[model samples]
Target: MDDNDEDNERFVRLLRQVFRFLHLVLHVLAGVFLTAILVGLQRRATDPSYRSLKRWWLHRVVKIIGGQVSVYGEPAPVGSLLASNHVSWLDIPLLGGQTELTFLSKSEVKDWPVLGWLAAKSGTLFIERGKRDGAKGASECIAKRLEQQERVLMFPEGTTSDNKNTLPFHARLFAAAVTAQAPIQPVAIHYLNMQGQTHPLVPYLTPQTLMQNLWAILAEPKILIEVHFLASIDSQSVPRKALATYTEQQIRLALRLNSA
Candidate 1:
């Protein structure tokens, strides 16, 4: 291509990125305001109306961020536990938009700006990651919620990764499913750019602050997220460790990765 043509293409791309970034900022601000209003309502956390509003807000955020989600299978029932691979911060809204489940997040997230406040208002469960008995306590809490017929979503990887592979699953949280006799549903999440290839920018890995990751995602012209819900395993039939291993294997196979 000619020099002028190349320069013009670059300029156009820059303009698009700026537009997307602006759009994301506007939507986030609006979401924050709406979340404040929801918090003022003083509805119980498990109220259906509360969850519906949160889900609607998440749908708007996903749209503004230019993410297109494609689901391959149906999500498990409300009383089940959803174990999914960790990809990005976007995973929260992506799954939230699709279902009314409460997420299990690190306690530190309660201190993050805007998003943390919204999460707290939405009744997200926070666990202290480094505490000696944190997982056991969190598992008991999850089991009680399951007994109440509330679905819970957890990322057993304990951290995020690039979308190319699955990390080892931590088995402690699986104890909740066994205790509650809830089915364990394994979910695989993958992110791709407009070209249908995995995009390195989507994963919120080490050394990348949330803002940097957010900007990188906003700059992408298009991001396609695929969520695959594999078959549900009966939690009562197997021990927590075996259940965790089986769930992890299902998710890996769904993502086309080897069971390592």
Candidate 2:
């Protein structure tokens, strides 16, 4: 390559490295802030103070990550079910940063560090797999939450995947919405890279080492997270199976992600 071309390449590389360094520093500060908020919330779970602090902390985290989340349609009623396709662990704070809905996650997540603690304190529901009655019990619990006018965000894919394709929504969870007569609100989340290109880094994680994966993500400059809320399906109109199928379809269409 010519001298000028080489110089330009070097400059771009330097800029990316500098941005990465800044990103890392910001992440450290955000983590400290999130932890402090979660701990404080834990101490005062019975009062409204915890929710207030959590909202502020989450908003700050969203700003720190340069993540711009846009809600497409009007939010459903307070007791409505907010369902979405699972992309990555980042979906927690990314979505939670927008709204204060409790998440329904796999039981394994309860073993995670600060995240697990925060989720638990925030009243997240953890489902244990490999148990016959687990689904039924969890559904009942979700129904109870809905009846109390609390929003529950569930990923019916049963596992996270690259947002490029949508997974089949687990029909079991929809039963809770059916029993509670709560509407199901579909949402789509997409991640764009620095050049505005779609990158798999959004849902990038593996069974081997989630921590290492998260660290690598922390080292990156930025990832754009989009949360698109779709139309709500009235429980009286759509059956559980139909609700699951329709939601999966709408989410795929909204984000142009595959739902195969």
Candidate 3:
């Protein structure tokens, strides 16, 4: 490459980093300001629910980040359980920005210092893997919530993938939806770049840390996040393992067709 090309590339990288850092500052400031407003709201005789507040804050943050979200399918109503393919940490905001969603995250996330605190405050349920009792308890809690007609999102794959294709789902997580007899809708999330390919910066693959992926997204000038809400499967009719397999296949097919 010529010296001019090298200089241009460096300049672009610098500009991207600067913009990302600015976005981070704005996100944090918005959180603090929202917290203060919430405190005052709590004192009043009547106020909006914390659930609504969270939804609004997340939605506003997505707007501040700037981009067009291409939603292909309709979101199932509030009472249904959302079964989606896991992509990146950004998936939380992208999904939450659309509608009120509470998800079950790994127990490790519950100990990540400030991030842990924020995750818990946002109503994330921490599930400990391999602990039968803990898993049972979580399932019960999820069932209770669904019974109350609250929406819960579960990433049955149990880990993040390349976002190009979906990993097989863990059937255990689908038990609660079955127990509650709630409908399970397979949701697909994709982060696309300017060239119509998977966003180069968004995947949380090996050797790439969470912060790195996040900063990469902030550096990019534009990105498109696609959300597809596939048909809902009736948890009442499908057995646990069948339900899990079907949901996974649905998402995989969605991404495959879109890429084609």
Candidate 4:
């Protein structure tokens, strides 16, 4: 192509990015405002109606952000525990859009600006990492949610990683599934660009603030997300550590990564 053609193409791409960014900001603000109203009417944290609203709002957010999600397998029953790999902050909206599940997030997320408020309203369970009894409390909370027939989604990696590979699963949260006799559902998440290759812009890695990540995503034309729900394991049949290992292996294999 000639220089003029290249310059014209770049200009068009820049215009698209600007439009996407504005759409995202407006859509997110509207969704959050409506969600806050619904949250006020929610009688309890686990109310089904409130969860449905959250799902609707999340779906809208995903669409506004130019995300297209494709699911491979069915999610486990309503009360099961979903163990997934952490790839990006977008994982929450991607999964939550299709499932009625509460997320297990780090306690620090409770301090984030708009996201923290939305997460809290959506019944997210925050874990205070590095605290002496944090895991114990989080485990008990997960068990209670499972026992009550609510699906709880936790990223056992304990932190986000590049979408290229799987990380080691933390065993603490698995104890909840075992204690509650809940089935463990393994999920693998991958982000791709318009060409269908793994996308590097999605991961919320260190030194990148939420605003920076949001801008990066909005600047992209499209993001394709794939979610695979692998076979469910009976928590009653294995110890917590074993359960964690088994689930991680299942997700790793699904993502085509070598098992650790």
- Can you give the TM-score per candidate against the true fold? 0.94, 0.81, 0.88, 0.94
lDDT by residue for model 3 (1-260), tens: 99999999879977877876787677766765665566666532113366776777677655555445899888788778999988887778778878778778889998985567557766688888878787788888788878877789988888888877777788877889989999999999988888888876777888888777766766677778889989999999678899988888888888874421
The superposed Cα distance between candidate 1 and the true structure at residue 60, in angstroms, equals 2.1
Which lDDT tens digits does candidate 2 get at residues 1-260?
99999998777656665665576467656655765765765554324566665656666555654466655666666798999888777777777767667679888878887667766766789898878988888999999999988888899988887767776788888999999999899988887777877665557546637655554555456677777878888877567898889888998989875556
Q: What is the C-alpha lDDT of each candidate?
A: 0.88, 0.75, 0.78, 0.88
lDDT for model 1 comes to 0.88
The residue-by-residue lDDT of candidate 1 on 1-260, one tens digit each, is: 99999998778767777887787778778878876776688677687778888888788777877889899999899999999999888888898899888899999999998878878888889999999999999999999999999989999999997899978999999999999999999999999888898888999999999888887777677789899988999988788889989888998888888778
Question: Given candidate 2, what's the lDDT at residue 184?
Answer: 90
**Per-residue alpha-carbon lDDT of candidate 4 for residues 144-163, written as tens digits (9 for 90 to 100):** 99998999999999999899
Q: What is the Å distance of residue 204 in model 2 from its true position?
A: 3.2
Error of 3 at 215 (Å): 2.0
Off by over 4 Å in 4: none
Candidate 2, pairs of clashing residues: 165-258, 166-258, 166-259
Better of 2 and 4 by TM-score: 4
What are the candidates' C-alpha RMSDs?
A: 1.6, 3.7, 3.1, 1.6
* TM-score for predicted model 4 compared with the true structure: 0.94
